[model samples]
Target: MFKISRRKSVNLSIAVALSFIAVVAVIAVLIPFAWENTPYFSKLVNDVVINESQQLGRCVFFVWLYICFAIVEACCVMVFVLLIRVRKGLVFSEISVDCLRYISWLCMLLSLFLFVGEIFHPLMFVMAMAVVFLGLCLRVTKNVIELATSIKQEHDFTI
Candidate 1:
């Protein structure tokens, strides 16, 4: 049994997510150096589909990677905040809905960016589709949260 107290669990999740963001930030900053020094990756980055049939340059590919990583970090931050709200007993608040909405939009933004990247790289096509699907699911979840918030407000008023 993996039973754990809710507060401890929430704190652990938040810590893990923050750690992930930090690690991703560090990796994103070192991406250029990594691509330059890693022999196999350097070759792949330079000799991939870009120079052949794709119009995107090496700089553009790096830019795409940075943007995607930024979006992921942003999403993780939002999730962290949302979990905090849950811990604070604001589970059905409008703020939570707004946070969810922003996350959904972020997902869509990542999807659009990946779609453009996919036009040239072709490898990003699956990732783009997956992000778009994630955005759609988040939108649905936001709606559900919004409804619950409204119902809770009404119930509170009646009480």
Candidate 2:
């Protein structure tokens, strides 16, 4: 395999990554609103029951925590994308690759938490979402690898 330059790979990864950030950000903002406004989601949220007020608070806290985590993960991706867009000459391919993997793992963990923590089966729904997010991350990783290899080959030919 031809060696690929980190810069080109990173640039492509960042471009693709920005879309992920936008999607995650939209979800992060919209989910709460949807839960509040949409009749179906509102019903689900309102229907959840816990033994005590403290437990109810805990449920809300957990939901908030999950959303916060998603926001943070998306922000990390966005920050890297911003860096890639502004900088030149050098590449941060490894960082981009790692971020995709880490974010996917985070989604998996959050899904597991929801699956186990929530009394209702709504956690299953969250888990399904996590699967989709993870799949997107995998696609990104594949694209990055392909871009890296292509860049490396191009640079080698130019040498």
Candidate 3:
């Protein structure tokens, strides 16, 4: 019977955690670039040119805040994966496949929205990279689901 070894399970968990962290990092870097270059933000700045320093400070603060937020998010995802691995067996499961698919789709949709917003914000390249990353994640999830289902069916037949 085809089975997922413990080592493979640990590796897959690590891979997913790494991917999640990478995605969050991309988003953290992209948002600030988009905000600073956006025409609406610029117009807002022009309206209060006298408070330029404050505005700049606020932007910097927000970027830092988001960086922290991304780190927390990544940590949460990693911890959750680790907990699952430690508690349950490491074999591929429907829940894991669904989580992967959901995250990929949501991130892709979010990236698309951000990219379109970049028309006025002017961070097209960053958003484009995010889109590509999300696309690859979606592909990964699709393959994972297929592989899991195939193996499950084979196991069932043998039993």
Best by lDDT: 1
* Per-model TM against the reference: 0.86, 0.45, 0.46
Scored against the true structure, residue 62 in model 1 reaches a CA lDDT of 74
Instruction: For model 3, state the Cα shift of residue 28 in Å.
Output: 11
The C-alpha stretches of model 1 lying farther than 4 A from their native spots are 44-56
**What digit string (tens of lDDT, one per residue) describes model 3 on residues 8-42?**
77677777767777777787677668866776655
Q: Which pairs of residues collide in model 3? A: none
Q: Could you tell me the TM-score of candidate 3?
A: 0.46
Where is model 3 poorest over a 10-residue stretch in terms of lDDT? Answer: 43-52
How do these models rank on TM-score, best leading? 1, 3, 2
- Flag regions of model 3 displaced more than 4 Å: 1-87
Model 3 gets an lDDT of 0.60
Q: Mind giving the per-residue lDDT tens digits that candidate 2 earns over 27-123?
A: 7667656654667654444555653464464467547556656645664664565456336533435555554556556556655555554554456
Model 2 residue 145 CA deviation in Å: 9.6
Best by TM-score: 1
- Each candidate structure's count of clashing pairs: 0, 2, 0
* Whole-model Cα lDDT of every candidate shown, in order: 0.85, 0.59, 0.60
lDDT of 1 by residue, 1-159 (tens): 989999999889989988998999999888778876787554545566536532355666777778889899999999989989988989899899999999999999999998887644567889889999999999999999999999999999999
